[model samples]
Target chain A: MTAMNPKLIALDWGTSSLRGFLMGANGAVLEQRGSPHGITALPEPGTAGFEAAFEALCGEWLDRWPALPVVAGGMVGSSQGWREAPYVRSPADVSRLAAEAMEVPTRRGLSILIAPGVLSHPSGGAPDVMRGEEIQIAGALRLHPQLAERGHFLMPGTHSKWVDVRDGRITGFETYMTGELFAVLCRHSLLGRLMPAEAAAPEVAEAAFTRGVEAARHSRPGDLAHQIFAARTLGLTGEMPAAALRDFLSGLLIGQEVLSALGHSAQADTPLALIGEEGLCRRYAGVLQRFGAVPALQLGNTAPAGLFHFAIAAGRVAAAGEPAR
Target chain B: MTAMNPKLIALDWGTSSLRGFLMGANGAVLEQRGSPHGITALPEPGTAGFEAAFEALCGEWLDRWPALPVVAGGMVGSSQGWREAPYVRSPADVSRLAAEAMEVPTRRGLSILIAPGVLSHPSGGAPDVMRGEEIQIAGALRLHPQLAERGHFLMPGTHSKWVDVRDGRITGFETYMTGELFAVLCRHSLLGRLMPAEAAAPEVAEAAFTRGVEAARHSRPGDLAHQIFAARTLGLTGEMPAAALRDFLSGLLIGQEVLSALGHSAQADTPLALIGEEGLCRRYAGVLQRFGAVPALQLGNTAPAGLFHFAIAAGRVAAAGEPAR
Candidate 1:
């Protein structure tokens, strides 16, 4: 009674949340589910807790297709997750990433392979690393092969990644704590004291954000610490409304990140491929466009695409089959 | 019998703590006292609560010299403080600062003048302001008049100030949130999670700090956010000890601040006058020296000296008297 189409399960398990995607042989998503039981939320560090959470999240799919192989990525493969899938150093590609996947046995007969994160050792700088984003990058290259030829990819989130891809491989990348800094400043710093208690409306946020971007564009790199205080001054001077302070701060941080990335990279004028959630990606895209970098937006989640690519490369899923197009 | 020496009280009343200096007419500290009852801890926002806290901290001195005039600086003059002393726009000197001091009536028939903060509008940049640090700058100038000729003064603290003084007046200044960012990162950010619970010892902190400073000196300004993550990676890689992470972070932030300030100012090669608490000032002096800026350390409390200068300029105290030397 098994379904005619063979399927594979791809899980994007992170520190605080988990997403399970059931995909057909051709990389088409069959069913998807999410849960808060991420690595940090699992009962314990052992196989039992991980299996329990995994089953709870995807037991229905397993019931429909008992032998579906699961490929998980992100924190689920970190030291604290279900199993430690050691990081693969750059320059890395889908093949190396897939080859490095760690296998774990489940109570049921299903096989699970966890994709490894990527690390880069800059010649004279501190090492850079990324976990889930590498999977997304793999998926991005699969979706837009043109990105592999030569392009920068920006995955904006808590720790935004500015990645450089050359000849279908990740050459190097830099991670900016822009998102985290924005959150901390808005929630914990004196600047946060001036923001409205609730979130600002979209239009209000957009306007303030634009102002912040403009400010950063005209400022020197060393002036960030000083520029941040402008949030308070602008509010006090009645030039910027208090409600817009939060978005303004967000815009400033993001704008600074973009400027910093461009200043550090050789691809300032080259178009960037942005892959992430719509809202954040759109925000990044807008800022990029404002700064004169053409940003090609690839919306919707890419973890499934990444996981599916890794699955096929690992020989867990047949590569010859057509996706359910 | 009233004290043989006529005296003035210099109060450094900030948000979290209060310090009162009983100064002789000759600008020598006769007695000093401190209390936890800062502006924030005062019972209420009005004059009554302020008076109560003031009495609790300095009632002894007031009793000794019943008609002594009090010169207060710092947050005590903010809108949330005892009385709003409007900020004097720069390029300001002690004269301009003294002219803008606000007077408030006390229950004991004593006069209180709160010295104004300084505001800087850097032409194309946002306005910058500082409350207590302006007083310190005045004191630094008074202690060593050479500083006024032309010098860069770094007052390192929660909101570190880099001041440009020329010809006995404050021309411009920039504020860096180094200390606050360190606190927030070590207490709230993921970086904090990897640090030891207790503060690092001086020697340990110094070594780690030097390393951080060196790393920062060689890095591009845009790479700071990425470089900060090196704290985590270094810990993971066992290149940096866990106990030293705090100091390393402190070093990295201070180093970045120094670099940024120098980069933004015209005084890169000029010796820096560091005025603040001994420990923080020493830390800054070391970092400054490492970066090839001759750091002249002005130790001990400068608030009293600053307050004395303001008292004389405002005509609350006689101008011809020499400071006790």
Candidate 2:
């Protein structure tokens, strides 16, 4: 797809990977690009390498249409990114991204705006931070105005974010490094060594996942590490499927977030909206319900939606927006 | 040391390595040998390559002291060991080793006896198991009868074990897997990626260790995985010593064990005795005290002393037996 007259280039750059969508003024995707390169791959933090990597991946589209404005989010705004865009603490409006936006210096005549992440530090729970999900959540709300009212939002990715919204503003959120930890533990840690040669069926993982979440809710938190060993023992003794161990681990993590969320506020049964990989998000929704949260899984490219919505609200979008590229 | 009168060889093999000590009828150290061969390294589990590896390392001793009576302990009796020496449930006696021993039919004309590890399902705490530490602890008690009474026993190694004793029997114990996890986390996990090029300094590690123990006591136990990020964050922010993260990690593990122990028992002020590397043991004592446990750090070679004492009690040596060769 040619970027001839795309309204905006929305980019989601995180720790280990990057994704971008060329969107029309109406918030419809015209073209998309994704790569393994992420903020973590930069040779030097906050160096030209960041720009070089992005240019290498997205230069073709930009060359086809030189005047397209860009809005980027995720780890691209951290201290190690192109420019440090400080987090806006909740309660935050969708316009916060545009309001607190940091301009990136570019060699090409392209105006690029990097959206800052959001941080929520309530009194009891651990301080949660996000860079990319904020833009998506904002976009999701823009797509469906009804979500502006009270609802729980789950943005699932490497560092899965669960955000709470009320009256068109983000009330607070929590970050669970679920995906990253799963990869690390499953591929690198002792747990990986103990895992069987073959992964179990998804049905097994699903069951284990459910049990794990429930276990996390009832058990003392410190007992989690030991419980992992129990999974292996059960498997070794022919009591549990190995695939379920992976689900159990996932359950433990998500269950922990659910438990922490419960600890933070009294609204445990609030309806939850999820934005993430379909399967993983469904797993999380299932876990949320286990902890008494009503959750709904949503589908869409949230970054572009969020960037476009937030950009328009912040008056960053040009008046002569192109709805058709 | 020559195997002048090697009567039998007592071996304590584990997951990663093997140790065999040759003794005369008096349970005296005739000659000792260790090798890279561990239970994991063996060609197959359950004693297939056990004899060959044993003979390869100390065959000379066996030949010199012809027709020796061999007694082994630890993983040698595990499912992964030479033979599955079934676990002996507590309250177990030393005579159980000689009476219920699993004998390996050897090609070297040596009558090999493998000691059974201990397994206990405490009425209060989660089920626990011991492999080599049971024998070592038994040996330590044989050497120091006073310690057989109510006191604390710390056997620090890969899976560092903290054992509790009351009235001449092991009431309960907890295995921290501290060393094993430390090695895994430092070399394999994402946490290791954040470590400085140099090793953590002793002083810095010591300080972090104390703080970590305190944090473990007061912090939400379920938040440990996230809390680990603090090690890197503290170092990055210059709020904590960079090299001390290792110490902090150690402290956290030990602190967790201490917390678990105190949680399950009514007596928190029972005298503590640590048996491990002098420095590590001392550090453990310090952290234990910081977390409100009265501890005593003992200076000694864990394996030799523990083995010696355990051998005498296991009846490998008669009361009037000759000194170790």
Candidate 3:
């Protein structure tokens, strides 16, 4: 039963970094490796660069199991990646995503399974799309089947997503640019001038953050442009130190995002789940706790779990109890 | 009456540029000069820099009228300017601003009157402020006294302000960082990536802008961080060109500011006025018209007019039909 050898190479690639997961027959991670070579961070350009990064991060594993199936997700499957994988329209399920897993033939006669992204078109709005988070959602659903009955999956990161899953199918979702907004404001706006480059002490930062959350939560609709100025004024008034402004901004943005969610999607007595980085998830959890809609499941690195599910469904790999392909 | 020669020197000094106005005995502007030397853009640093900028901008006018009163308003009275003129609390009027003008003694043997800024403490919120706008309000009140009776004065710029005035006094005001937010996001956020560095066709830009304003106006409260993402999505989806994104963003932010104002301050059939740059004020006017609260009075560069009002009140210059001081 020491067959924990890598049965699949799962790669999660994005704008800034790439993470590879060596998954076993049972969808468990056997080993993990990471690289700074994201789709845009390649040592070289185009397919050659992607190939080099892939080799650098997973060459040894590939050398040991030359025929092992490889699955790549995130922006790596976008128009700018090694090979493009088209997005699966919303209301899609596991079979659709698996059926859409693209193949890129390599010189070694190996086919890399590129995960397709998900796109949703809300009436009278621009189409919303996601590539990596789709995989994460699949993994979350695979990890906890009960979560599929009815729930809102909150994935917090550069571009956060609030996904609606019902009867085990993603019916719809929306993307909130909270993290990117926070970064742009803190790095470029006048508000960033007083904020020092250093991090503040924990308890003080948390308190400041909570204050920001409370402010955003209680503010009126269309008040963000008005209220965010407080981040500067509060510091100028000597009510809070510069060190705590970052967290305060974080809490304010997340609080507003949560407030918007409470208006329709994430609500009282409804199932919710948090997925992404641990600290980010914890922050979302804490903010949601304020709204009294605590996430039912908190998971991390669900991309590999999601890929495993897709691979099995696509027949790229056998079932969990069966022998490895 | 040909003595329209400079009777007073008024300078509206702000962060990026300075405007100097030479006034006659009756408060009519005899001449005007502009300098790129704002508080933060002086040729040198500190008082020396400020003095140099002042000398470069007004040395000729001062030489001709050595006894002329020199009055300055805006950031020139900020803590980092020639001298700090502390803020006058809300419920302030022209007389309060005139009476509190601080004089900075210069090596040139002339007293430079600095306008004090206005501050308001909203219950359970951070204090709000405006240094130059108070001067503009004073000018507006002097220009059209009926305006001060009951009106919401909208001052749109990097930081937009909605002032509640009643019975000839500024009762309260709130600041919105709309222009600043739009600038930061378009220059630094992902939304800016697709935006080209050139201007789009005017008619196309205006339509896009109106679309953005409509979106923001219709969005739910706390929905800005969500709605703004459309700036990127709409471009990616080919519903809009990259050139139109800037205008769209401008409209969205202004729409949000207007939305918040209408929520409490700016309402239908109420007296309203706009004081700021012509283009910005026009944008606000357009957005407000969408809400059926068109500005009643629209004025440009009211700071000098404000200075003239303050100068007469402070006895720096003789009133109309009076002899020169």
Candidate 4:
């Protein structure tokens, strides 16, 4: 006989978009739908509007499977979200919510559960914030027990994160605004003049990139302006092409990430796992490899995969204390 | 009586714009004309096109005063200009250029002298290039013979140059892309989102500027990105307003100048003369004062004064240098 339909809704609501799945009790996606709406678009009188939007998007499938538990994640749980999910200090697990997971009562008598985002910050340390991504990380860990043993998980996106998972728990993590900076620099800075509007090719100016990376390693982020001038002069002097300059800029940012990770942890042999766009993911992996960290796994559908793991853990289909696969 | 018509055409052709003053060999302007065209806008044909466009603007004036000797300065003498004006490495002066001026035969039968710009690279140093501005510095030195003994000149603009003039020659200088970077960051970066198209009020975030300057004094220029995130987070935490973040970014760049300058020069009492926009000049003065360098002169019409000094030294004017007040 086929497994029964899952009872919980695993949702990923980010700053610019949202994704949700109606899973069977077995933790497999039964019906899925995503919308353009995001936490940023939520108006004041937050929960009421959020609940209505949430129902309008997922109510049909829910009506068919009545009384399904809904577990949401992402920016929707932020201060501007359906509810302000308080930040959880680092060294947290699946069962812990930074703050009370928000529960919104729908007009249709449906109950909605929103997962709290996590903030992993060491004392006198740089802080990391995640709403839905932490849930995804947790889910990913649950789905892959082997990955939980010891490794670096790079969840790359708008605000890419580097998470360290050890013994089935998120030991710690850091957020690097790599994607955001790249976007802003390419689309908004003088550097943008050289970058084509669309994704074209990955042409690395090894020398320039290496220089930038070295700068990042040795200097703080504020030094980018001077480095930028150096790079521009390189272009002006015909030492590098404009396109190569773009690549060099990207490499500098990635190099900074690699250095930041190294700063946080001294694990040299620890395997690396990358999750994000294939091209960017490969580039990051390349950067890691160049920095001497070999990747162990690369996941393509990080959001859905992580969400699946989350649902299984929440539904008890994957029993607590069971080692992650 | 009005000053006698000066003998030469004093040109200030920079990266973005060009200005010319026609003199009657007496070091006094008879007519003045400025064009949007600059070395940055000139075609690759070099001299041919540059001469054509330049002549179109000042040919008639030259026709009227056929014996006028034209002395040009600025980017028009750069490698990309009408003709390459070889850089006169450190500690060179008007006499140095007098021996190497490019003599261009004009259509109006006038002898045009192109002043060679200064190229200074102290021992194991970064190369700095200056063209028309050097003439102004020369003029300032001529005006103030005492300043020739020792002092610093702050010629702030698109590419602000801080020149160390000693013994009536530019010994060395450092170029800071403060203005250009500010333009790119404000007009092309996310920071632009904070302010409208118009220039913002100067003191919007005096605190961020001061803080950024302090940060720059201690940190390397390569580490700017991390500090940017600090600004962003400050905004996110509601501790810093978005508008103030603009000031902070501005501070970061200017602060880089302060720190970068320290490593180049050892003189603590070298007087600084600011020649640029009054607003930016004021800010730099304040910044320099913070670092313990007080302004000795604040020039309002630097180009004309620079041309005057350069002309007398280049043999276009036979007048002895006057003492600068």
Error of 1 at A251 (Å): 2.0
lDDT of 1 at B86: 81
Better of 1 and 4 by lDDT: 1
Give the C-alpha interface root-mean-square deviation per candidate.
Answer: 1.7, 3.4, 1.0, 4.4
Q: Give the clashing residue pairs of candidate 2, or none.
A: A74-A132, A139-A305, A139-A306, B8-B69, B28-B324, B47-B82, B72-B113, B139-B309, B139-B310, B200-B243
**Candidate 2, residue B217: CA error in Å?**
1.9
- For model 4, what is the error of residue B219's alpha carbon versus the real structure, in angstroms, after optimal superposition? 4.0
Q: Report per-candidate DockQ.
A: 0.56, 0.24, 0.79, 0.22
Model 2 global lDDT (CA atoms, 0 to 1):
0.68
Q: Rank the candidates by lDDT, best first.
A: 3, 1, 2, 4
CAPRI grade of model 3:
medium
lDDT of 3 by residue, B130-176 (tens): 88999888888878888877878889888988898888888899999
Between candidates 1 and 2, the one scoring higher on lDDT is 1
* Model 3 bad stretches (over 4 Å): A1-4, A322-325, B321-325
lDDT, candidate 2, B1-325, per-residue tens: 4326555567778877888786655456667788878888875544558767887877877666665556777777877677787777666546555466677778765566677777665653335578787776666666677777776787766666667777766766766555665676667665566677676666666677877777677655355555555555455445666677777766776676566555655666666677768777776666667766766547454454445445555555444545422
> Against the true chain A, what TM-score does chain A of candidate 4 give?
0.84
Candidate 4 structure quality by residue, lDDT tens digits, B1-325: 2655545667777777788887553355677898877877764356676777678667776666666556778777777777667767768887887667787765556666777887664443224566777887877776677788897888766667778988888888766667676676566554465454444355657877887777666553334444444455445555566667777767767877766665556887777788777888888887777777778888765676566666666667666444212
> Top TM-score: which candidate number?
3
Instruction: Tell me chain A's TM-score in each of the predictions.
Output: 0.93, 0.86, 0.95, 0.84
For candidate 3, lDDT tens digit of each residue in A1-325? 3676767888889988999999887788999998999888999998889888888998888888897988888898888888989888989888888888888877666878898888888887667888788888999999999888887899997789999998888989888899999998898998898799989899999999999899888877789988888888777667788999888888889999988877867446658899989988998999999977778889887888998888887787787677544
Off by over 4 Å in 1: A1-4, A43-46, A199-204, A268-271, A321-325, B1-4, B43-46, B198-204, B268-271, B321-325
Model 2 lDDT per residue over A1-325, tens place: 4334577778888878888888776777888888877888865455677778778777987888777778788888888787888888888887766788888878786657888887766653335566788887888887777778877787765556668898988888766555665666677665665676666787786777777776677656455455455444445444567666776777776776667655655565565677877776776667766766666546666777887886676565643443222
